[model samples]
Target: MVSIIGHHLINKEEGYQILLYLDPQLIEVADEFDESFQNKEDLRQVVNSYVKNRLPDLKVTVIRVVLGSLVIASIPLLPGTEIKDLDSSQELNLKTEVKEVFENTPQEIEKDLLLVNKNNSLADNYTPLNLIVPEVPFIFKGFHEKKLMAAKAATALEELFAAAKANNIELYAVSGYRSYQRQEVIFKSQVEKHGLLQANQISARPGESEHQTGLAMDVTSPQVKFKLVQEFGVTKEGQWLKEHAAGFGFIIRYPEGKDAVTGYQYEPWHIRYVGQEIAQKIASQDLTLEEYLA
Candidate 1:
């Protein structure tokens, strides 16, 4: 019959499980896992093949356990360690034990996020932003203040452009992941154009910027020069993006009236990729990333 003794690997909820059976005589197993197969060992090679084809990442095992007179086929649950030379417990002892391995898995991983710090990693960045990039017609170059973007930004941007076209929205990446030096140049240009007073209202200092992370974008419709000014957001396409961008794992970096904490002015054109779930929380609560993090 069908058994549940195997890894229950899934896109959203993946982990380990076990399932097996026993017979009355228990002297001999009617079937033994091909070692090449899994919980569905009763069928044939096709069973293992099916799971392998569908889940290239899962490692399956079909084993036989003795239950007094009957021998049953089962897949036993175990820790995340290798199953080879298993010596922790005897065969009959495993029948009544259960361990919550996946439940024990940590919710977040520590990473080295050099942009935020030399160490910033999330073991589980469960932010659900549906922001997948699609194919694009062409690529365009952008500048913030007056500096070039990173290669990663250019690549990710091409995907955004493609997604915009397929979704029937006019979108473009005006500026993308930039560097400290580039940001310094941009900060200088803004100081020149808007003067120091107005410049702080727009441009950002080098180390204090998110664009350096290669996961943000300054965008607009093709009609605009990728500007962070007014008219861009009022456009139909801009308005649409403002309403639905978070669904795609993106967030409007700085919106109206949060400049006090953002350390800058409201910029409708700036979008950051913080994954979908995290971005949604940031958007729904009227919180900037800086505020949310704080």
Candidate 2:
């Protein structure tokens, strides 16, 4: 067990706990191989050797157990499977397999880390449950449907606003949830003015908008006249939000330099709620929502 730790086979305390909860027979095998292993790679080789010799039928499962759940789940496709080998029918079958695996994995599915972009659109009838207005300052006065966000996101936004206020930086919520119909109108208007190519870069097309998810909010400050603009990114409020929004479960949905990946122009004012843990990780890694989810 100590040798395993020394070899970095399990770096986290949670991994050790998981090992203990796993089959005791496997633990004995790990103990026997511990002294012989020099590092994680060596241990992996030994495990592969064992699987080849004694546990041929359980190779994938055993490899996954040893490597940790994240590695097992995060792979876009199955191990040893090539994208080129997949025909249309085989591709569908692979997608079904991956979807089934993700569905069965609660930790993966319950994170609310949904990805919404041009390629992945929500249904026109889709509406988030538990929509509520966040108790935060807004650019516009009075209640409006656009002020509403998913309950958890609303709560997080309130906390985020309070924190910003405490720093003497007043943050205002500009927009939140938008219905599919509202998105269609917004997109069409942008297209009429800016042309389709420019509109597609700046505005989401109907169901493709993150505003429909009720988990995204456009935040602004008085520095920018409470407007969402690229110049806002240079403001103190924007800098502060970029530095600390993750603390309250938010992330800059489309960061600068990630437009190609996110399928939209950089939106410094747009923040998406994906909870604290994930938000922190995404921010720390400097990843766009598309990259984080991918």
Q: Pick the candidate with the highest lDDT.
A: 2
What overall lDDT goes with each candidate model?
A: 0.48, 0.65
lDDT of 2: 0.65
**Candidate 1: tens digits of C-alpha lDDT, residues 104-202:** 221111111112311111111111122233233323543233233334334445655566678788775555555566666888998988898887667
Give the per-residue Cα lDDT of candidate 2 at 5.
12
Runs of candidate 2 with Cα error greater than 4 angstroms are: 1-111
lDDT of 1: 0.48
* Cand. 1 TM to true fold: 0.49
lDDT of 2 by residue, 81-164 (tens): 422332223211011112222221212211367566664445555677789998898888988999999999999999998888
Work out the TM-score per prediction: 0.49, 0.65
* Backbone collisions counted per model: 32, 0
